[model samples]
Target: MRYNKLDLNLLVALDALLTECNISRAGERVHLSQPAMSNALSRLRNYFGDDLLVPVGRHMERTPRAEVLREAVRDVLVRIETSVATQPEFDSRDTDRTFKLFVSDYSMEVLIPHVLAIADAMGSRAKLHLRPQSSNPARDLERGEADLLLIPGEWCSAEHPSRVLFDDELVCVVWSGSRHAQQGISIDSYATAGHVAMQPIEINEPAFEQWIQAGVGAPRDVRAAATSFAVLPFLVVGSELIATMHARLARLVEPALPIKRMAVPFPLPPIHQAMQWHKYRNLDPGLVWLRDLMIAAAQRM
Candidate 1:
């Protein structure tokens, strides 16, 4: 259990140190006393003949050599943890890992409640962290910073493997007593009516509707724009303004607001919510279980 006359135990300490970059934090992670962790670091430095961690203004930063070894060390530890340290079957109730997901607020509302409730009921110590999605989801997945991306079909890329979670259509919502509701929407009426819309989100391409409309110049009028779908209900309630959004999200907030969901006056393409993950983690058992659980949650919804 030795490498280059260095004890194998040093690798565990090294992994923790490289991951955390702080002696105290690394010690806490691996259950070592601070002094013991320091000794482990000294031994590693002696073996590698380099300062693996350099002190920097009350913080520790990994040296270039340590940075070079970080992924290899972490991967080795993960392999051992996955193949040897734990039971053959992933014991969700006993796992203490955290999963990072890239998702927007609407997807979070739909998935987290169902998924976490099930995990909590099973006595799981695992935690799910959602990062508000940005335009660079594909890159985030490739870099392993995100475990999964829950995104609309238009924004998703086929560069990564994906599973369709659910399909949804856009619906125009108006206040229950609005003119659009009472008089019914015609093409001309729909074109002239004041509308609230979600601002464009795509970075590389135009939104689905934008692409479809091409040169039509966006229907007739946009009275207001909101950054998130969650604001649609509040923005439309008791107002004559109409807002178009995903039907499922419209349903989620419909009961809370005096609003009615009606088909969009024009035929629009359907959008799907899908789960996408890195090719590197596609077969990871814990992630596979999580993906399956998410699919199940979507089905139930």
Candidate 2:
């Protein structure tokens, strides 16, 4: 497509250039060679009569004109994307589109079963690409790399529209033969107890008190630390270390781990698991159908 003798595709290059400010990085984002991106930038500069990107020290910086165009360009592109998407005929039962989901470990264990069950009932060949959520999930959605993000509501970005799927609570997980199992976990016991710390990297929202940003009452003595929740079983059992995890996760994995679940003596805030999507995708029928399906699964969970 051409607009005023301009290859409209260069608008994509312009968006990337203004966003990244580095020619090489912009080229990588748009799948263009550095030289090709440079050429496109030259054309854009000639057309707009502005040095859109300027070399500052060793880094590239957007010019004042580029800064002014940043949000304008983004808005224009989002409008274009929404317009194009609204023209598609998307029927969930007949569509074979693949959706990429950034799902947290807890959600994957407790809620993914319901999502898959509903998908099967829909008689659709739609495939789900499940990936571990990154620290910056909102950016992932904005870049169109992920179709949906399943995370706690607090972590959801205002940039995208989101809805709560379900609420979960923290619970104490102990070996079936542990003292806490026979008795109960009290505030004093919890504070003095040697606890298993499941330290998560690049996580903004944690389902339990093990991680920072969610702890309320008191801190526990960190006896052992594990990277993922999957390793909690090994670290919790056969040791004096007690573990804390989501109530739903503990109940689901109870029979297999020889673990007993108990309510925390001190109340923890309820975590609202939410499903969020890009605002640009609001008018996309395919995405709307999937969002509705996800909401339904959340309700069932």
Candidate 3:
């Protein structure tokens, strides 16, 4: 369908292209072939008389015109999705909506299982696409790429609506046979012990434990770093390395692993896991339903 000689369908491709800045990836995002995406890019270039994307050092970069259109295009698509595409009333059992969520491995282990159980009991046909935490989850929510973001309260964006789902505290974990376990961990020992850290992929910022330790002028002797919090315990097993992680996650893994959880020797703040969604999608019925399910799951926890 053309409006003023512009094919409205191209806006979908344009959004993908501008967001991804790569033709093949954009095509894959929209389920279009690479050749078809190339054709769409050519047509978009012709219509706007500008190269929306250009090659730069083996990577695609958006042109100035494309940069300007990025937010505008995203906003248009979000409005259409939330306001026009959604139904007035949500019936989870009948709809085939796919809810995309950004979550950490911790949340996936502690909370997501309950959600799936509840959804299954309700006979909901909706699909869930669980994505790993991204470097810019707020941007993904703003662009309507993520239906929800489950993260610590401190990381949530103020521009969106958020609610705390559950609370967890940080605990120190050490091998059952480690010297620290036998003697009990002290502040000095915790500060000087060889530590295994969980660093978020694609994120350059310090982890929560690191930030807290920095505030107290304490430094960890990090011996190894893993991307997933679930791996921290495994890394600590049969080793002298200590790991600081969420208490809930530690409890879940402690029964099977020969690891012991100890109280943090320092006063660290509790983890308030939160759920955030786009401000404009506050009224989306399907999202509302999914959020309710998640909240219920958290309540059960």
Candidate 4:
């Protein structure tokens, strides 16, 4: 279909359906009465030549076509909203909007206290919603399920606007007075030690394949493989298992736990944490303000 032939209003209705995933809820999101929403859905169906949403058991399920269009529709609406709407001035001192952020548990352990301190000092009324980082970041942003994503720079996509929050080096953490903390950690020693393993960002098994291929070894001695980075230090502190995590997080967790950072026996790269937002939000005033606040919080940390 030609761009000129498409009705922009239909895009808004489509965005609502995609966000709410229910006709009634979608109607409410767009401020259309139930009957009007049904009519709009009908019109959308005719225009798209497909049932955008189909009843599946008790809930509405998106059609393949609808799923494919979801991101595009969301992007378009976000662009329009940013383009036409006046940006609201965000006063952290009095605003009540809740900001949803996706971050690794490890990040929260280190970053939350500092962020809260900033909020406290600013006397902001906004609340922060922190969710664990999932494998699907693009989906979260498009659905409005996540307002912002916190991730390592290696995982960030240029499709989204990003700002580097800080750089962190790797450290091997073990119990403060544990034998491992006082002993040498040669490559073989590390390879043979029991450890708890985790990655701050989601990684596939194949990515680790390259390391194993490069004469580098795997954590063959891992007692447990956890999906959350935040749990690594705790697991290390409570057990004999050693965990390799970011230096910043290690520092944040050290005071509260019986863990110590030891020099890595082998070479590793430093990790960088960054805040990412969809480009569609580039011009939205409220989002801009919130982004600045997040950056400021990171700086203070």
Give the alpha carbon lDDT tens digit for every residue of 138-222 in model 4: 6777666677888777767767788888877777889877778778567777777788876434645323324422434563566
lDDT of 4: 0.75
Best candidate, lDDT: 3
Please rank every candidate by TM-score, starting with the best: 3, 2, 4, 1
lDDT by residue (tens digit), candidate 1, 1-301: 9766778778889988987898999999889999999999988998899999998998889999998888787666655654564434566777877888988877877667887777777787877888888778886665456888898776677777888888878788999989888888766677667888767366433255573344234654778877677787778888788887778888988888889888776677777788897665666777887898897788778
Off by over 4 Å in 1: 1-89, 200-206, 211-220
RMSD of each: 5.5, 3.4, 2.3, 3.8
In model 2, what is the error at residue 237, expressed in angstroms? 0.9
Write down the worst ten-residue block by lDDT for model 4. 206-215
User: What order do candidates take by lDDT, descending?
Assistant: 3, 2, 1, 4
Candidate 2 residue spans exceeding 4 A from truth: 1-7, 17-34, 45-72, 205-217
| Model 3 stretches astray by more than 4 angstroms | 1-7, 24-43, 57-59
Error of 4 at 133 (Å): 1.6
What shift in Å separates residue 146 of candidate 4 from its native position after superposition? 3.0
Work out the TM-score per prediction: 0.69, 0.82, 0.91, 0.81
Best by TM-score: 3
lDDT of 3 at 237: 86
- Cα lDDT computed for each candidate against the true fold: 0.78, 0.81, 0.90, 0.75
Clashing pairs in 1: none
